[model samples]
Target: MVSIGTAEIISTHDAYHSSNWPALKPSEKKEMEKRRRIGSKPPTCEKKCYGCEPCEAIQVPTISSRPHLSHYSNYKPEGWRCHCAP
Candidate 1:
């Protein structure tokens, strides 16, 4: 036995499906596709750390040569570290 709430939900769902929605224009569709493609790809870093440290005490390299830790979006020479780095 279907409940009143279930029946209302089913009717609403059917109405929504039956409703006419405006189709995207060719330009809008192309823009959306372009955005999706751009958004899906990873960002490239402009500058990379060679061998610098924020502080002399912190002898460890700010950016590791390791492939995993190599990519940095906001790498500041002054900070000597990536803003996103943990």
Candidate 2:
């Protein structure tokens, strides 16, 4: 069975504007990247259809220094990058 809870999903769109999102500390970045390299790739995003609720909400209440999103789907799109953990 495919697992969906390991990694936090993020969009390339949001990633590009690093300023909007808080920066990860050097150690945090290193660890996240390292885990990503060793684990599976992040999930792609899927947009909700007209009149449909979002597949999943993408933000959650968090107090961690590192920024995070609530949900992301595997809807393939060009020029987007995703990250997943094992």
Candidate 3:
């Protein structure tokens, strides 16, 4: 997980999908490490809404770093987990 401004989002690379995942910047990586090490609240944690049309329709504002560097997405505050089962 990494903290971008105010929101802390999960950062992952699915090797099964592609091997070209971008690498994190040294500074950003360091900051993410610090947050993970500190075990902070992630600044935001919301319930995982599944099959809720309205909830899915509401998109909170977000900021994205360069796709060539950081590939962060699907930021669930802290406790929320994807309800989608495999």
- Measured by lDDT, the strongest candidate is 3
Q: Model 3 — TM-score against the truth?
A: 0.23
Which stretches in model 2 have alpha-carbon errors above 4 Å?
A: 1-19, 38-86
In order, what lDDT does every prediction score? Answer: 0.46, 0.47, 0.48
Q: What is the Cα-based lDDT of residue 56 in candidate 1?
A: 25
For each candidate, how many residue pairs have backbone atoms clashing (under 3 Å)? 0, 7, 1
TM-score of each: 0.24, 0.25, 0.23
For candidate 1, which ten residues in a row score worst on lDDT? 52-61
Q: For residues 1-86, write the lDDT of model 1, one tens digit per residue.
A: 23685464446546656779676799988997788673223233234333433222211334445656546544522222222322
Superposed by TM-score, candidate 1 places the C-alpha of residue 5 at a distance from the truth, in angstroms, of 21
Q: Clashing residue pairs, candidate 3?
A: 45-77
Candidate 2 lDDT, tens digit per residue, 1-86? Answer: 23468975556645556446677799998997788674244343444333344343333232434334323544323332322222
- Tens digit of per-residue lDDT, candidate 3, span 1-86: 57799987654544423556577799988997787775333222234445433232222334445554444555533332233233
Off by over 4 Å in 3: 1-19, 38-86
